[model samples]
Target: MNTTISKIHPKEIKKVTLGAGAISINEIIAVSRYDAEVLFSQDYRERVNLSRSVIEKFLDEERVIYGVTTGFGSNVTETISTEDAEVLQKNIIRSHAVSVGEPLEKEVVRAIQFMILVNLGNGFSGVKLATLELLRSLLNHQIIPFAPGEGSVAYLAIEAHMALVLMGEGKAWYNGELIPGNEALEKAGLQPVSLGCKEGLSLINGSTSVTAFASLALYNSIQAAKTADIAGAMSLEALKGTIKAFDPRIHSVKRHEEQAITARNIVKMLERSEIVEKYKDYRVQDALSLRCIPQAHGAVKKVLKDAEFTICNEMNSTSDNPIIIPEDQGDALMVGNFDGTFVGIYADTMAIAMANLAKVSERRLDRLVNYHVSELPNFLVAKPGLNNGYMIPQYTAAGLLNEIRVLVHPATVDNTPTSANQEDVVSFAYFAAKKAYQISKKLEYILGLELMAAVQALDFHQPLKPSPVSQKVYELIRSVVPTVEEDRYFYPDIQFITNLIHEGEILNTVELIIGKLDW
Candidate 1:
């Protein structure tokens, strides 16, 4: 399946329905990046009302509920009367919405909003139906809250910032202008929602922020994995590597699904190549980086698949602190679902996986540029000493790889207690997801460098021509970056190829020709 979301024109996409267990990465990307409208289903409204009625009955009976008729965290023992419930909810929003740091990207905030909306739509959070509609209004109107990138241990801090926007208390971007949340809501013909029956606690008590980050990173990493295969194939042609290593017969015995798929993709991409066929018996075996693209890249693929499974599961689940069970007659059950340990650990795993991908890509770039390994012109330039072609890009890749190494340290393993030890043991899943996002970006750039070098080396093969698929990739690359007969400014070349990778042009073009590769 092609999990990659293509960049669609904003006007082409229609309003999508969001609900529990139905939110997809494509849907999130559609609403967030493509500005598609969203609608809350009538089913969600009915469910919300049923859940709300339970809470209302409890309130009428003077029953104490955690974070509702009582204070939050360590203050849970302090009970409040019905008259003070609204004030408690509002105060939680006011005190908890203290996130500081650089503002999160618009796309991240949009995803967070979508996840929160979906979590509440699960009909277990005890928020009023009107409050859910208000969030839907924000999504449909393209009013994005200015959520900060830090101050989240679970998701309370960031979710508070998002909820504040609904209350018209935070900042938001509307019509491409950053304005007060109140003004944005007014301009969008929407009004701030009032807290009623656990609305404020329901709004901010979830793991939506880390879930959104992991979801976005999973999509990007899948694309990066496929691009790595394409770039690896190009490098194979440049080095005249043996396809014997990627033979299905060789991979079948190992029985690793991702490895076999990657080996099969390498074979398919390099099919009918005169270059690969010409050097049938020149060497016994290639080096590990060249010979084991399937092993390294395939391991990353497995890791991504695991993280995808974990994240999608998280998306379907309600991560709220105290879940309202309408089936149990609206009883609020306090649970630890809000803890983001699963997302944090899996996201950390993905960070290591992406870092490994970057490491191999950087080393492959080394192999392409070094004459000792590639047997191409020194520095891949005809006049090696004078025009240092692609020499510095390898160093750049190395530096990026070094940074990835540092980022791969498990954020989950290091936890700080928050909320007065009432919430002891925090999950830094947000930081883990953030680092994975950063690693994926650098991974794309590193692959771009490899593609640039591989194409340069393949040019030396002359009119021999590459595999039909490789020829298309080479031509597409040349369309943006010409053959480097001599080095002019190379940064522009890197930038263009990086853009190609990021824009999914290269992946889209190759998949168009060769069909979809195994994810």
Candidate 2:
């Protein structure tokens, strides 16, 4: 495949400085998505050097440290001589780099690299300063490692694959070409360094992969959540669904912050709507999908909110085994900080949350196309029988929802022992975060179909226009996809609208009209 890496102007590129404070989710997104440059603060360099000195002191004292003088996992008892310590480190990376599948997207690989910096840069992983410098060089230069998308439990195989690139052993993408790792480094004016006492273990061990996926997924899921509100508002207006359910008084009585905020957002989006005003008191209540949107969408928002805290904490944490503590006199404490339970559970929860968002969106999509309910023409088309306008798009939405449902099964709930049962009770957080990321993409498409159908349903209302916010959203959709007078290839229309949702165009447009939606 032809892959081209675009170069950003130096002045335009944003730089994220580590070691100053905890890395935020926005900074991670900046590096991964926007190619933001990463810099190490002087304090970060000092801390990393201090941590590395601890390992050197341990080796000098001939103290038996885990993964330093002793073998890892099940082979913890196996001792290694000083001369063979470096070999063992390199060997572990080679042995563990066995993940097999399609290569992950560059953004994900970049996120993994950034998380590695965050984890080791905390001065607990005993990683050498040069080691982190190389990793940062790879990110700033856009030399992405070729990490496979599958075959990881917690974070071992994939991280091993990534670690191999630093050793100048595995393949990497550089300047749009998949080249040898060493060559990629060479082209980028850098050289690989030999693994130190615990460098390899520090590189591969930990919850880096799971946390990387969770961070990216959480960021996108937040955007998708905001877009879901816009889509739901448009659907409510199109269905002539009453806005009484969204009154501040009704939501205030419940005392759920997100629920009240969602109710307010829906009301704000539908302000000055001729369609809604004409249909006010048209019926006792609309369908639960339209009427109870605040409750349903707010619940999803709550999950996303909770996930942000968990994921951001994980982002700034050091999830290394046998973390080195200078305060404890360079003592290498063997611990289970690498366990991915917290991140795994949250990632799984985010997946379920996104699936529910799609579920509610599909219901509203049905209301838009099904003539039995939607007052508009069958399937939101001018001539429904002749051209199957939106009949099949709803099917597409259902298919995507089904795929998301299958992925919602928590991977963290299951485990298999490895390392000769020494590393038993594994947290399959890698898959959980991976599936959550996958579900977020599918949810975007589902929401896109809802917006597409909702826009069509609004067109039928004619002189009785939607609210100002909804009209702005409609214009944005119409700019990308024209009204479906007669169905031509519908996939492009769905794709265009999906792009709008994915790029936050719909949310951005709505927010411009009615401030920001509450988290």
Candidate 3:
């Protein structure tokens, strides 16, 4: 229910022009998170019209066009006259709008709208220019469709729910209030659009939902990855873990760029730390949780990079079926571009990578709170038994990690054929991307708990100051979440620090002091 548009001030609104070139992941983030306004280039308008002209010409000749003249899916053999084309389009939206569960966040719905523009703006999906304009108007006016969060195999159901809002037939959120779609559009000074030919099919087809979820998840995963390094560094310093394991020579010989980058990032964060310098040879080497920071976190970075590449490519590409080949006089070709296999596989891999990242952070959190291994006070509190501080927080991290583990099971591996098995072998990419998105959130909370515990453990070291970067990060967290003196309501503290991670406050604070962490 929290709308990104409410957070945007007039002066801060950014404009992203589509159809001029490939859409970048950052541009999607801009529109989704920052409430950036979207615009279409002149070239995009021409392309859309060209493709639409093809559809209109086919309709005039009464040529057979899937989803336009013929029925959809298993009903492809059923032919419809041109007079019934509009009814077929409207019927598809009505029948396919069957997604159920909690409504998705406004940001996600906004991202879906933006992806629709990118997918259809290339003159492939034969949607009318006016239809695309109506969608743009909805986004600019902050009228978000009330899309259900579940019940999607490869994006049809969710997208169909969203498309209903275009016809003023489903629910929508206008100015933070859920209301009838028609009223929402009326309040925004926009009228409902009339479906024409393939407009309805174009609106709901393709992997827009999967790509949108994956795009947002990729952005958050990258943020969590950076924060993991900072959290690991703080824990290592608190445990008085040796820094020799982070030596550049050791990582350079490993022959992985991300591994070396992570090693260097840790060294940079712990630079000139009295805690690390004084205990440089503490017990020869630290635990694997501390010593393998670079390798573990680096492997996550590699997965994140691959996911970014795949998801970004999906954002720019069209996934429409019976795609209009503009060069061949609008020859419609039935293809499997709508299959979300590429994005689904990468998104599943992203969840697995993030699970491993959280697992190691949970291990480090254990080292921070366990008195026997940490050498600090039990639970990092002065009076251990009476205070019972930071003990249950580790349990919370473990629970979150377990949830992420269960979610990492690839959704792509399980296929359920729909449309009477005529559409067999689905991608299930929507759930895959959705699972990855959920895991990113759990990962943030786990990292947040580790950060909170690390800061508390640092207090035990007293006057031995942490590195400048680590100290700044500690202070940044302390600004919102005060140090725990005894047992208290930890949920508020946990939630506050989690917000810090989600908002990039910790990563930004560290980066400002040490430049950007290596990708």
Give the winner by lDDT: 3
Model 3 per-residue lDDT tens digits across residues 227-295: 999999999999999999998989878888999999999999999999999999877888999999999
- lDDT ranking of the models: 3, 2, 1
> Considering only N, C-alpha and C atoms within 3 Å, which residue pairs clash in candidate 2?
none
Top-down TM-score ranking: 3, 2, 1
- Cα lDDT tens digits for candidate 2, 1-519: 111111222224499899998777777778888899999999999999999998988988889899999998999999988989899999999999999989999989999999999999999888899999999999999999988888888887899988898999899999899999999999999999999999999999999989988988887798898888888988988898888888888988897798998888888888999999998888899998999889999999989888888887777789998989988676889999999999999999999999989999999999999999988899988897898999998999999999999999999999799999998899999999999999999999999999989988998898897899988888887886888888698888888989887766787788777777777
Lowest lDDT 10-mer window, candidate 3? 1-10
Off by over 4 Å in 1: 1-14
Local accuracy by lDDT, each model? 0.85, 0.89, 0.90
Query: Model 1 residue 388 lDDT?
Result: 89
